[model samples]
Target: MTMKTSFAFALAGLALVVLALAPLVLPDYWTGVLLGMTGYVTLATAWALFSGPTRYVSLATVAFFGVGAYTVAVLNEVMPYPLVLLCAAGIGMTMALLVGLSTLRLAGVYFVIFTFGLAELVRQTVSWWEVNVTYTMGRYVFLPFEGRHIYWQLLVLAAVTLLISWAIGRSRIGLALKALGDDETVAAHAGVDVTRIKLLLFVISATIITLVGAIQAPRWTYIEPSIVFNPTVSFMTLIMALLGGAMRLWGPLVGAVPLFLLFEWLSVSFPDHFSIILGLLFILIVFVMPNGVLAKFDDLRKGNRA
Candidate 1:
């Protein structure tokens, strides 16, 4: 194998070992934090896989995530957990394919607005269905699983997401994605098959995001449209990807750790002012590291080499 591939395999093994041992030794609170952060990391990583290379700026994380959550809520008791995840993936991929075909042609602000609007549409539709058809506010999903098991499950999912992302980053498809992002018309003229690649990446991203949502569903005792469809998840996913360095493989994981910690701190210590504090921090990150902190570091390393 190539040195790069070998290094990647070594890192994956190391991460697996760490994740496996973490829940056993850490306190319950820390294990829970690991679980939550891993979920967000998976979301950010999945988003970066598509949005970073293609610059699509999707706001549909909440929509796909909520779909998976609601799927679990509706099917948790009817099927095994593994089967429920497969169902969630299928539904998410179907939604992504339809959405991608419709909106992938649009560019810039129109695309962003469409995605954001789609999230709102899904949220509203779920709310309406809950009130009218289901006649309920939320559903209770009883997971007969332990906290450690959940943590390990999330860790495995995150690992798989990262591996796929890394493979894409190194392959020819990644080159095509970058070219398409730079200039879709030119890339298409050069026979890059822009439409097919973007749609494939979108479906892959949606599948991973939905799977994370499905796996995390039972973490909450009650699942509601309002909770699962919250815009905060969408916003954070984008922010984490940008903050960590969207172009790099490790950016989302690096960004998710500190940001998640800060979010938890502000939410607990200054709940009323959490938004204000987080907003200010986000502004600082954007202003200081527009291409992401990882990109800045990469630039510095390149300069040093020169």
Candidate 2:
């Protein structure tokens, strides 16, 4: 490996070590917060894996995440936790494959709208099933495990996501995706196999996202369609990726950690205005630093030198 790749792997290893040890040292509240943050960070990174390189602004995260959560919620009673988790991942991959094949060809605003609408479609379908067939508002899940167990699981998953993203960013496939993002027609003309790569990345990304939802579902004890399929979840994932620099492997982590903390603070201190504050911040970022906070900093340094 080259120096940069080696350094990135080292950094990822160090981060994993720290995350693994964090719950041991943290208080209950802090551990819970970290668990949530790690989950979002993982989701954001998974999102960046496909969307960043492809420049596809997908809002389908909620669909996959909700599918994972619901799959576990429904199957946990009949199967072991590990089995449920695996099944959830499979279901998520299937959903991604179907959705990506059908909608990946749509470009620009149409693609975004289709994804957003797909999430709502799934949410409504689940809601209808719950009310008409199950006659329940939500499913009850038994979580006999401690908080730290979930925390460790999430930490490991997040670490793996970081590693995978870093590897992809440096691989030949990464080049194709980057090229695809620049111009899909050119990438295809250059023999990049655009369709296959897009679908594969979509499935891979969905699998990781579902794994997170399945692993974390037990911590919630109860999950409703509306709760799991909330648009805010997808929105936050997108925001984190954008704010940190979606093209960079570390972007999701950089975005998720601080933004999650800020969200927690706002929810606690000014619950009524939390959304407003977050929305304004998002708008400000879009207008002033569309390339991301880190990019903006680099630009400022370059200007200073000039």
Candidate of highest lDDT: 1
Q: What digit string (tens of lDDT, one per residue) describes model 1 on residues 48-115? A: 99999888889889999999989999899999888998999999999999999988877756778888
State residue 63's C-alpha deviation in candidate 1, in Å: 1.1
lDDT of 2: 0.87
Per-residue CA lDDT of model 2 for 96-165, tens digit only, reads 9898898887775777888879889999998999899988889988868778899899888887888788
lDDT of 1 at 161: 93
lDDT of each: 0.88, 0.87
Q: How much lDDT does candidate 1 score? A: 0.88
Worst lDDT 10-window in candidate 1: 297-306
